[model samples]
Target: MASSNSLLSEMQFLCPICLDVFTRPVSTPCGHNFCMSCITCYWNDTPVCQCPICKETFEKRPDLKVNTFISELASQFMSLQVTDAHIWSADQQKASCGGAVLCDICTNTKQEAVKSCLECQTSYCDVHLEPHHRATGLKRHTLVDPLASLENMICKEHTRLLMLFCKNDQVLLCDVCAISRHVNHDVISMQQAYKEMKALLGDTEAKVQQMIQERLQKVQAMNESVKQSVTETKDVIANGVQDLTTLVSEIQKSQKELVKVMEEKQKEAEEQADEFISGMKQEITELQKTMMKLRELKQTEDQLCFLQSFPNSSLLPHTMDLSTFSFNRHAEIQHIRKSLSKSVSELKMLLNKMNTEIQKFSDDTDVSNNTMLRYMQQFEVDIVLDPDTAHPLLTLSDDGKQVKYSMGSGLWGIQNLNPNMFTEHLAVLGQRGFSSCRFYFEVFVGGKTEWCLGVATASVQRRGALVRGPGCGLWAIWFLEDKFETFSSPNVPVHFGKPERIGVFVDYNGGQIYFYDRQTATLIYCFTECFFTEELYPYFNPCDNEYGSNLDPLIIVPVSRME
Candidate 1:
């Protein structure tokens, strides 16, 4: 059976083209066997139809088909090969031993060692190790994990195991060395020395871990600082661009107005000169007509005619003396020219002094606070709380401008049946919704240890626990656990001093939300590139009243303009 199996395992089942066991064994007309795919691929690559092994040619490419008999035999041969692979023998077992240390006592088929004896200086397999466990004499010897070489553990000079530790020299010593050269040294057992060194190493490891933690914290701090610096720098550049652009526009406008003023002055002077010239031309024409009449009378057979036509002196026009008729062309615009000259000189002085003004603008930390707040104040709206949207345990003031978390039932024991009312969270929305380009409002959070303020879309979820963020139609910041953070995915912490009043400003068209410390006019944070498709209402939450720490009401105070 073995001989027959060996003969079947020969190259008879292999494909002549692929030189391996046939996958889908096929036969050609010339009686040659090959893998079906290999023959097909080979035929497709070459123009001529021929067999790869025999080089036999065919007139037309014959349709190749898998040979079931050869294919079944190939399949049986593959199975036989797999079966033989699992039959492990002693030689295979020896090869499988890998690089482990083998028993020194076993002459044939050595087994892997489990332990090494210090006294015998030899490694032993589990079977051979049984003697040391049973024998009283060998039981006294020390056994350790197998070592490739036991020479290192023995003292070179004493030819004995180093079993003691000398503290003075900080070295391992043998039994003979302990009483010889190391006799005067501070000696102790090796186990005790190991315990002490391990304890010291643990302390060093703890210190290293603490240093790593400190450095990690410092890295986080530096990263945060870099982020803050980048944000501030971008803000500064944007503000500088806006300010400089506005300044340039104002300069251009002033220049246009100045040019108009000078042109008007010149036009007035030209009109006055034209009127004087017209009067002088009319006088000259009248004088010439009078002279022509007198000449005709002097030659005259027309003396009677001249006396009849000549003269009612009251009807003749009177001419002014040439010396007294003086027109000062420069006089008409003289005052205007003087004013323009003075203005130009002053403008030059201002241009030269612009360095200080620019420096002041750069040094002004509160410039944005004042400028932005003052502009945003123009769009300020009076925000009043909506009782319809107030949570069940929330109380609204009579003026609808303040809200607080109620300890017991709602205010006046009136249950709100409104569909828009919040059923879970201690929150309320503004009575009026804003849909304009921009809006501003302020909320006084004084004496309150916990609060939330911002704007929410009109379609915000009110019946259940509301998730906070743009995705939930809410863009807000809150103070909780004595820390300020935005209600974003992985909430971002805001580093700023607490303010009594928070000013919320929204630029709907620009998709931005800004929170300001109203007291100091400081910009606390801004949410940029937000999407506001629908009307938004002011959102407020005064936290719970269970803890006396947050009993203060959140008031919607009127915005005060800052100049």
Candidate 2:
């Protein structure tokens, strides 16, 4: 019995089709477990012998190696069950008086009826069950052992069945589990567990690879970007270094030029200083000579006093002897006085001559031109943005001092031009040369129309007056009325000389010009039509409180008025 149990445990006893104890052992082409009755029933009574698990058909039946071990184990299990049933109360009721439990098939009919067979594990009435259990050759028909049915089953956990599996941690454990134990434990659906796990593992693997690949690409791109940035930075720094070096060189050159000029100025000053000192020294020498002359005069006067003091009383009392001495001495004193006067006069003339020569040498250089170096091109006129032949030029702000410029050509304004004033004011052009107002919007007025426009004195008075020269009045751009009754100021203000598209873009005070968009303002366009332009050469700025040249705009763009 032990050998039979051991062999049955090694042999696979259950039929594949029934998943139960084999009904009739049979062999397939693969020599695996099968039951003749089970396979034949599923084969639809066909002659084909096929492997049930894979459906691989065989042309001929393989030799049936009836597993003696499985047969013996089955017989032993059945016999043990039957023998145990003889002691049962239900089986004892149907036993013979000799203690033999007889099948009703071999026993006599009793008044009491018995139905179920304990040993056969079947139910029947006393009339059939007794006979069924008592059938001579088939009394030992197989009965299942319930307790042994599940004894050999093992769980996926490699433990006993009826156990729990933790999901998060992928671990199987016994039934004494707490929430803490399963907090990170792997649990699963017990019935469809393997199929679910296969799908889950495949999905996880694919997702992990995808994420890793995405991150890898990102890292690579970042590294490349960093490298490019580093290269660009290096280039920028190199450019900066070059610019710095150039600036330093330029500064050094300027410094050298400055030093050279300064030294030349210092030399001139030194020469002047030396000339001044020499003159002073010469004056000092003359003073010393004059002092010597004065001392001599004092000595001669003392001598004369001494001679007079030994007077006429002691000598001959105003008489003949005294007359001789007085005559001789008087003539000598007169000669000495004449000599001293001549010497003093000569010294004065010498001092005066030296002072005159020194002054002539000192006043040699002209300081005006060199000091005002920046104002070198005092007469150069810059033709900023030309007269607008395109759209209307609108001046945003003009105080006749400074102008704000904007070109509202699109939804927004852009391309700003900045404030630039002429060294000589240009608000009124032709301050030096003549300027022509040819036509305003291409409306031609016949003949030599001379529009002498000038800014005359306004009540407020313009601040930075530019055209303040003789023959010019207040700040204005007026067109000369060729006809006696010509109301050109109000009628045809602008003349571009011919019938052409021209726009006025300026505020007199703000000094701005808008030569681009037409939709911004009609006032500016009206002013343009009012512009009285005349052709003249060498225009002069009159000495009146007239127009000043102040302008504003950072960048300027021109547009066609017609377009």
TM per model? 0.40, 0.24
Candidate 1, residues 9-76, lDDT tens digits: the string is 66687777778999888888999888999999999989999989789999999898888988888888
Candidate achieving the largest TM-score: 1
Q: Cα miss at 543, model 1 (Å)? A: 5.0
Off by over 4 Å in 2: 1-191, 298-563
Among these predictions, the greatest lDDT belongs to: 1
Candidate 1 local lDDT, residue 480? 64
lDDT of each: 0.81, 0.41
Q: Given candidate 2, what's the lDDT at residue 164?
A: 52
**TM-score between model 1 and native:** 0.40
TM match of model 2 to true structure = 0.24
